[model samples]
Target: MRHLSDADVEALLPPPAEALRLVHDALVALSRGEAEVPPKPTVHAPGGAFANAMPAAYPARNLLGCKWISIFPDNPSQGLPTVSGLMVVNDGRTGAPRAVMSAGALTAARTAAVSGACIAALAATGAPAGFTGAGLQARSHLRVLEALGHLDVTVYARRADARAQLMAWAEEHVPRVRLRVTDDAREAVLGRPVVVTGLSIGLTGAELDPSWIATDALVLPLDYASSVGPALARASVLAADHVPQFEAVRVAGTLGEYPATTTWTGSLLDQARPDGRIVCQNLGNGLSDLVVAAAVADAAEAQGAGHPVDTGSA
Candidate 1:
């Protein structure tokens, strides 16, 4: 077996455009029943933290993998990463273990890649965008948005330091896009054609006013109902990457009073864009993890970039 560090995974990751293409393919396959992905099961931790076990098989692409990822929202205060995990890629033919790679970079990449696909398929290029949360997902999404030709973005972050840090990073990395930071949530989202929320899940009193969102905006909530709550989501054409997972989460009370009619995001890609507000809650999907992790494993093997481990017996 081979082991890849976070840095190695980051270096092996596909560019935003390529990443988006990969995720788009996976989503399409999933929609067409060409992949096997069980709903991810969650386990809880102290302090409102949780972890998920995501397993998926993409026989069309000859890929198989599972990711164990955890989100501890309070970690940042302790100078630790909020998200961390590992991915195990298996041989599609024999089910033999192939590689164990850091999941952080891959998770962020695939997530932003999914959002990129949504933006490309749903919204106009360079439309004004708003983002809530200035963390890892925000940075990753900024890269994707820039790749998709979105040049104007406004971000809302409660912490001045986070906003400043993100701004500085954007200036150096995504120089083409202009970023405006705001402390007010309404100011960030009002009338924006694209709005992405990445705030911590399980957060209360952080939901945006439904009136603040444009009637035709594309709202992508990566963080469940943390920032995009029930009332706001109820007013939109709600869609999710996996309707079963969304329904499960709703049953668990994460999404309260959500609209009964929900469509799969991939299905929307094939159909005419629905009129009115569109909220696509891309709850993380294992098929995406399988696709991306397989790519990373292939790259690692080709470049000889990871550390090989010898399992004595197997």
Candidate 2:
């Protein structure tokens, strides 16, 4: 078996354009019933922390993998990342583990790549975008947006240090993209052609107002309804990356009062862009992780990255 660390996974990630293409293909396959991805099952911990087991199989792409990831909202208080875990890539024919790699970077990459796919399919380019969180997911999204040619952006974060860190990172890594940091969430989201929310999930009293969204804007919420809220979600033409997963969460009350008119995001990709505000709540599908992880594993094998471990069975 090949063992890949977080650094290895990060180094082996596909380019932004290629990542976007992979995610796009995965979504299309999912919508067409070409992929098998069961809804992720979760185990809870104290203080609203939980971990999920996400598994998927895309035979058409020759991909099969499972990701075990945990999200602890209070990790930052202890100077730790909020999300962490690992993924195991398995041989499609034999169902034997082939590679194991860190999940943090892969999760962030696939999530943002999915959002990039949404932006390309639903929103117009060259317009200033807005983001409401400044964590790893937000930074990853910024990189993807930069690759998509959406260079001008506004970001709103509650912590001064976090905002400053994001600005500094952008200056060094995504230098072509200009960032405007703000303390006001309204300033970050209102009237933007594309707006993304990555706030901590399960927060009460969601603040964004539906009226602030433009009539023709694309809203991608990575934080469930934590930042976008029920009112804003209800006001838009809502969609999700996976309809069944979205419904599962809605039935579990994670998405409070979300409209029942939700459709599959991939279904809208090939159709004409719909009018009025659109909100595509991407709950992060396992199929995307599987596709990207398979790509990473293939690249690692080709480039002689990651150390090998004996599984004894083989």
Candidate 3:
């Protein structure tokens, strides 16, 4: 087997334009019912940590993979990343594991790519956008917005240090964006036509007022009820990366008090109205992760990247 480290995955990843295209195609395939994504299964650990297994099979692409990732909220306190895991890609014909690779960078990139796809499919580019909760996801979103198209953005974070870090990284990586950092969320969401938030799933204790959103803004909340409120999701012209996944969560009670219903996928981009809230709530499907990781693995193998392993089990 071949093992791809985070660095190898990063090096093998395609350029932003191509990455966006790959993610876009994956999402469209999901919308067209060409992918098989089972409901995610989670195993809770101590101290509010959990490991989630997200498996997806794409028949059209002849790819099948799974990402077994964990979120340990306290890892950062120990100078470790909050999220870490690995993705395993299998041969579609024989179902043998072809590669095992790191998933942190892949997760961040694919999340932003999905948002970028939604933006290109539904919103206009070159306008001012807003961002809330600056962090790794925020950085990915910023890079993606510039990659898929150019847009000036204003970012607001609860922590000044986080905001500063994002600014510095933007200066180094995505310098084209005219980024404005603020201390509060209002500056990020008010009057902006497109907003990308760094809200993690299941977050609570703070709520963003619905009135703060622009009348015709497209709210791209990558998280669940954590960042974008349930009330906000219901009132808006809702869209999801996976309709069945959203339904699964709703049925499993993860949606809480939100009135869950069928959401607009990419296919309805042209029909999406601007008069109300245009919300893209991506609960994130395993299929998206599988496809992106598989691409990285395939490319890495072709280019003679990553560490090769013996056939014996470790």
The lDDT leader among the candidates is 1
* Separate clash counts for every candidate: 0, 0, 0
TM-score of decoy 3: 0.92
Overall lDDT per candidate, in order of appearance: 0.89, 0.88, 0.78
Query: Each candidate's TM vs. the true structure?
Result: 0.97, 0.97, 0.92
Over 4 Å off in model 2, which ranges? none
- State the lDDT of candidate 3 residue by residue for 1-314, as single tens digits: 68998888888776667777887878777777778887788888887678889999987778888999888767766977777899999888777788898998898888888887777877776757888777778888888888766568999888788888988999999989889999888877788889887755556765577888876778887656666787777778787788877777777776677766555465555354556668887877788788788888889789888888775653
Task: For residues 66-156, write the lDDT of model 2, one tens digit per residue.
Answer: 9999989888889998889999999888788889999989999999999999998888877789999898988899999999999989999
Ranked by lDDT from best down, the candidates are: 1, 2, 3
Model 1 weakest lDDT span, ten residues long: 253-262
* Worst lDDT 10-window in candidate 3: 264-273
